[model samples]
Target: MIADTFLIVTLLAAATVRGAAPLVLAALGGLFAERSGVVDIGLEGKMLTAAFAAAATAAVTGSVWIGLVAGIAASVLFALLHGFACVTHQGNQVVSGMALNITVSGLTVVLGYAWFQEGGQTPLLAPGARFGPIELPGAAALASLPVIGPIYREVISGHNLLVYVAAAAVPIVAWLVYRTRFGLRLRAVGESPGAVDTAGVSVSATRYMALVGSGILCGLSGAYLSTAHHASFIRDMSAGKGYLALAALIFGQWRPLPTLGACLLFAFADAVQLRLQGTPLPFVGVVPVQLIQAIPYILTVALLAGVVGRAVAPRAIGVPYVKER
Candidate 1:
């Protein structure tokens, strides 16, 4: 019985990884944009748009890969729109991002209704049209372990290929942000655009590239949420996880590992909330489900309020760079 309890706890821990994947990817996307002096408040919209695109495309073409591409393309277009406003026009980043979010929120439903007439939801796909995991060389071996290994197999082994992509992206992003020349210049532009400009790096170009990278990552995250996790896209399925990712971004101080940790914390809270709905509580005797559902939001609020201090964001963040005339 003790061994059984340990196995169950390990399984929950492992499952938290899957629950955290979307937020991790989205946070990584926000990391690129924010670290490069772009405040992508529209990430929520971008994810929603991508999710809708992925589901619609998959439903029509019966190809998950095409759906993923379509989702990324759509997110890129939206991110470019934000880039045009903030980078080119020197518009207010917050206002521009809010506008984009509102635009996608409305446009997706209208277009989705027009295209598929499914009342803002897309048809579910067959198994082949959805994303699934790959069995790595040693994956089978991992599942056979006594306690911890079984938990990994049950929770992580059957996840979609995008899960691996999302996990791999953390180190890749960290390396790109810290080790590469482009990463150095990207941070320079964010920290001090004037310095970056004096160094002969194209500040505007770097910011645009960062935004585009953000688009691809967020789009991929959204596609995974739709085709890989749920197999169908609900309107506004993102449900503000983009904003949560942004919070994790600030909470982690713009670093990859810390941001992933923050994401896991939130995901764990979410998973606990879901799991609690099934059990009976002593004394309280059946707490309201809404109270349980609010756990993530409550944790987020508490972290933002109590834990965050005077953290300095990138110097050029939210400030449009202007080349000297």
Candidate 2:
């Protein structure tokens, strides 16, 4: 009984990390864009488009690498378009983002029908085209060690490469946003674009660059979803994770470390729900499936309602830049 309990706990912990990986990427992407004063509500659209591109390309070429490249390219294109409308033309950021979201949601379905004729999904990828868990070197050799070996194997190792990438991003983002000159300028641009402009920086350029970075991260998240987490892209496969990422950003107060914690919190809730589903408890006979699915979203609303504290956004966020002559 004790061994079974230990095994269940370890499995749930690993699952939480898995569920949080994409959210971490998307939340970090949102952080970069918003830190540069760009409201990227279109993260959903970019992710959806990238997922389709990745799945379709992988299905065709039988190469996840090519699919990853295609996905990032597609997302970068969409990000540039958003930049064109919001940064260049000074369009309403929210409206433009929503429009992009609507456009991509429909466009993917149409393209899927035309290309693969699978209604709205791309063709299922081949074994070589999908990413699966890779057992690390020395993983087996260490299993005889004490608690550390088993914990390392179950929670820290055995995930695909993207999981490690997501884990690495936390420190990288922290350094980029807090330790670099460009990070200083990026934050300044978001808080006070006029000041950044007065300091001889191009506000549009900074924001556009931030959007590009955002695109890369979002694309990575999408590719992981289609190629690593699942073997194919399903219609609306993102399943509102993009929005959930935004909530995580909000809950984290836009900081890299805190935002990571927020993502893991949501992911942990999801893992718990997965474990609880159809399980009998002391008081509860069996947990409902719908309630299990809703746990993470319910936490989102609670967080947004000030469960922890007020989440303050950047000062000049969502405001378009107009250079003063």
Top candidate by TM-score: 2
Expressed as tens digits, the lDDT of each residue in 58-108 for candidate 1 is 999999999999999999899999999999999999999899899898888
State model 1's lDDT. 0.85
Superposed on all Cα atoms, model 2 deviates from the true structure by an RMSD in Å of 1.6
Residues 1-325 of candidate 2: C-alpha lDDT, one tens digit per residue: 8878888888998999999999999899999999999998988888898899999999999999999999999998999999999999999999998998899989988999899988888988888998889898887989888777887899988999889999999999989999999899989999999999998999999999999988999999999999999999998888888888888887888999999998998888789887887788778777786786676677667766878577778999999989876
TM-score of 1: 0.92
lDDT against the true structure, each candidate: 0.85, 0.90
- Residue 207, candidate 1: Cα error in Å is 0.1
Off by over 4 Å in 2: 283-292
Worst 10 residues of 2 by lDDT: 295-304
Record all residue pairs in model 1 with backbone atoms less than 3 Å apart, i.e. clashing. Answer: none
TM-score of each: 0.92, 0.95
